[model samples]
Target: MAFNYEQYLRPGKLPHIWCPGCGHGIVLKGLLRAMDACHLDKDRTAVVSGIGCASRLPGYVDFNTLHTAHGRAAAFATGIKLARPEMTVLVVGGDGDGVAIGGNHFIHACRRNIDMTYVLCNNYIYGMTGGQFSPCTPMGDKASTTPYGNPDPTFDIAKLAIGAGATFVARTTAFHATQIDKLIAEGIRHKGMSVIEVLDDCPTAFGRRNKFRSVVEMMKRFKETAVPAATAAKMSAEELQGKIVTGILHREERPEYCEQYQQVIDRARGA
Candidate 1:
């Protein structure tokens, strides 16, 4: 049976602002599917986003959504989670929004092990603003700001999330459409801070600057480079070089921040 996505979307929110052939739309569909798989209640679920192309997602979704300031999605979502512990909070943003300006907020949320899911769309460049190089942009990649080629090292988002204490960390590319929803559903089901990095494409911004002829060419790169975690385990370090390891990379049980805060309140009352 064909899944009906209209129920989860707002009326007249069509014609999303994303450039043609951009992968953000693909990620959006995967998110909606994951929401359905998790049986998320529109009333009880809150989707928050910082300013970016990916951040525009919440505006179309029929849920408790917040289109917050640039690079502040994690901070806003943290507050929402702390206030309404029962609500399922989800954060969505691009690479620049999640790890550049919002990097501190993102790491702290992970360290606290807050009960929320952050879906980071890593398109490698600042697509909406300008074709600026982001933290995740590959070294030597061309961007509007780095026409001479990016000289800085790129961030490994999954490893960063795992290091920062995210209890659940997963990664997949937009090319792997089926895997996107599966990983997102798993992240949503996890108790502690969950970060799902979706490697997407910005054809207009990143791709054109990097010499990708079409969206299909960009997607082909993802398909060629992505390796499953289980498969990666069997490969040597040299073999895994430049490979995007997909699937659940890390997961662990931890004391959720809200539960601990509740204990503090109880102790204060007793005192």
Candidate 2:
């Protein structure tokens, strides 16, 4: 009862696969803390993930975990939530898996407003599959796929979710560990679909190529660049460039997909 992580951790996988300085472990810790804070039933919870360094989270958690194919976490999570309406389904993955290859699914999931939660670990690069540019990778950043500089525009994940009809959306960073945990806990408690975009770090893949001295330095940069919601509202667009805005971006009431489907079933049976 004292927030025992061992109760929710997988057996025979004591040590994680992430690198020493990787932020994935930090993100995982935040997620576990969130679950504990929410007091979610371990047996009734399902964590679904796609193929990526961060996607390895589902495997380590002791819940009903599913390790799905690349860029398919949202799709798999959707199915899980639809089938098991009683379960608290959560989706976890990296920027590459959630936004790059899984972009379509992500949008559809948001539009459906299913009762679920999505935690996107945005490390800016494809850490597991080599140091490649990801959808959330900042413009002009250097990566193995973008040796010179990335030409594409980066995604504002919280904004996208808001526009796509997600009932709840929040953004936080691994640097703000406690905030991330609280955001995840609140998102999970919300009824409709919620998204928590956690900006993490890939020291090996992203930091080294970008001239960051160390993980601590990168985290410091995150702290400096981050702007709180109240502060961001007072700043102009010009002043907000390169700034990471973190907080609850949006929240609204909506009917969950599965619940609506059940209503239709009830109507048909009555008819």
Candidate 3:
């Protein structure tokens, strides 16, 4: 609230549609704060999102915003960054939109090392269509689709980003507001592909079904489970299980996709 993020928000979209106690708003604010902190030019920034409760954030921000097709936000952002390499492109999407149907695109984007920042809102359930289990949903978690419980192993998106060759990767929960802002800012500043996997809460859809009594309880759980990378290094794997390791998990300097393409163009023109 102290931050002047409101200035970057679209006044016409005064009222948002997210359910009460949902953590998407917190993630949105962190992104805006990061944008302001990084001194990014709003006019030169493009905010891309896909279909979902969390994806609606782009509609509220005053930028070159694109609310693209379901599970295709990253693909759309890829095209934007390729065309306007000078512009700062940021992507916002839910777990379902980013890693479920769009998982392949997400993987390739990281592998390509395109210059962009992606804030993947992982609420562990599909909050838009229904409270169904998502790719990040923990095992034994019950949902509308998984009445008995989710039997599939959950994905740690940070590891996926690292394995896929993303140059920057980090994770922070919505409750860690200040930390998330810093991570987002760093992700924006990184030259290659960066992904900040935000452990956001969907109180209305996921919390109600996952034994979370209230939003406060859900946020408190994140604080209880989160361990910084430095601290996690000392803990045993058994002790670290079920804990959310929050911070910059991976970073490596790599040739960015757009810049690499420009080299080819420069060579072709000379020839």
Local distance difference test, per candidate? 0.96, 0.92, 0.93
How would you encode candidate 1's per-residue C-alpha lDDT over 136-177 as one tens digit per residue? 999999999998999999999989999999999999999999
Q: Look at candidate 3 and tell me the lDDT of residue 256.
A: 98
Tens-place lDDT digits, model 3, residues 60-107: 999999999998999999999999999999999999889999899899
| Root-mean-square deviation per candidate | 0.8, 1.3, 1.0
The count of backbone overlaps in candidate 3 is: 0
Question: In lDDT terms, which candidate is top?
Answer: 1
Candidate number with the higher lDDT (1 or 2): 1
Model 1 worst lDDT window (10 residues): 125-134
> Which prediction has the highest TM-score against the true structure?
1
Candidate 1 ranges with C-alpha deviation above 4 Å: none
Q: Model 2 over residues 57-111: C-alpha lDDT tens digits?
A: 9999989999999999999999888988999999999999998899999999999
